[model samples]
Target: MIVITTPTGQIGQQVLERIVDSGKSVRVIARDPSRLPQRVRDRVEVFQGSHDDMDVVSKAFAGAESVLWLVPPNPQSGNSTEYYLNFTRPACQAIQSLGVKRVVGVSSLGRGFGRNAGILTAAFEMDALIESTGVSYRSLRMPYFMENMFHDLESIKSHGTFYMPTAGDQVLPLCATRDIASTAAALLLDESWSGQDSVPVVSPDSLTPNEMAHVLSEVLERPIRFQQVSIAEYKATLSRFGSEAWVKDYMDMVIAQNEGIYDDDLQKVQPSDTSFRTWCEEVFKPAVLAP
Candidate 1:
């Protein structure tokens, strides 16, 4: 059996779609099973609860050969690191006690940067805990997600601009959630590889925020500009909607990005298939045009 977590999320939903028809027994743990598509509900066994719940994961992991683990984001989280590990620790115990064969987890880049990168550091710690369980594991260490740009949809639609804490000319790798899902599904299906490893999932295009704006302009047929905001301003904006710890941690993450946390991995790999221009034309443009 293959157990999937966060099956209703962006990347997890795509992973479920790709593997549901592969003749593998699929089970999912969800807080609200009703959100699952009708087709998916009909096919997979549903365990209705958060994956962090020990009872929930212990039962869900039972008789499963492989599992796809993804920790859902919580902006109101108190301590970002503890928040991530809280969700992970239970699953780690279940992975060991249940005798699961393999685990494919969603993680981030900058694992060894030795800097406090907030959520990125949390992800690195999660990787370490999972590795300690000794289950054959693959952590998809992804870069900046192109889908993250959707958060700026209203700003882009109104002013033809996007904002970030980093410089407009700073180059960073971008990956689509689709690529991450595809990579996870491929790994889940193949049983040949084993042991703990990080699969750096990144796209070929290394573009600056300014270059991204240019691609968005061409794709949307409008001139869009990139604006570099102060980290304090970014923190202030986030603080209004998130916990104090969350705001501080995420601000630290943005600071790390500005300081080149993604640079090392960006220089090493570009395994993902999507590019900025292609994503702008195919994904971003359509969203911009949507009602």
Candidate 2:
């Protein structure tokens, strides 16, 4: 059996679909089973609860051969480090007790920046805990998702601008979530590879924010611009909604990004098969045009 956490999530849903197509016995841990597509419900066993719950994961991990582990984002989390670690610790125990042979986890880039990278630091710690479980593991070290632009959809449509807490000229690596899902599904299905490794799923293009704005303008046929906000301003904006810890961690992550956190010399990276312009023309354009 293959166990998937966050099966209703963007990348997880895609991964579940692909794995289901292979005719494998699959199970998922979700808070609300109703959120799962009916077709998915028919094919996989549903453990209706958060994966962080020991009872939920212990039950789901039982007799599973492989697992796809993804730590869902919680912007409202009181402590980002504790949030990631606490969510992962239960699954690590379940992996050991349940004799699960392999694991494919969603993680981020910027492993060795030697600073508090907020969420990225938390992800790295999650990767470590999972690895310590001694299960054969594959950490899909992902870069910035192109779909992150969707958050600024309203801003793009209304003001012709998108905001970021990064230098305009810094080349931000990008990857589509579909590519991340594809990578995870492939690893989850295959039982051949053993031990642990990091698969850096980054897109081939090396585009700065200014270049991204240029592509958006041509694709949408509008005058769109990239606006670089200061870290202080970004923190202030985030502070309006979430808890103080949440705001600090998010801002710290952005600070790490501005400090070149994702600028690691990754070797043997099999570039993800999506470009910024392709994403703009295909994904972004439709999103902007949608009513």
Candidate 1 residue-wise lDDT, 1-291, digit = tens = 999999999999999999999999999999999999999999999999999999999999999989999999999898989999999999999999999999999999888789799989998989999999999999999888899899899999999989988888998778999899999999999878888888998988878999999889888998999999988888889988999999888888878877889888767775778888888888888889988
Which tens-of-lDDT digit does each residue in 37-56 have in candidate 2? 99989989999899999999
| lDDT (0 to 1) per candidate | 0.91, 0.90
Compared with the true structure, model 1 gives a TM-score of 0.98
**TM-score of each predicted structure versus truth:** 0.98, 0.97
Q: Positional deviation of 166 in candidate 1, in angstroms?
A: 1.3
Q: Which 10 successive residues of model 2 have the least lDDT summed?
A: 261-270
Model 1 lDDT at residue 166 = 83
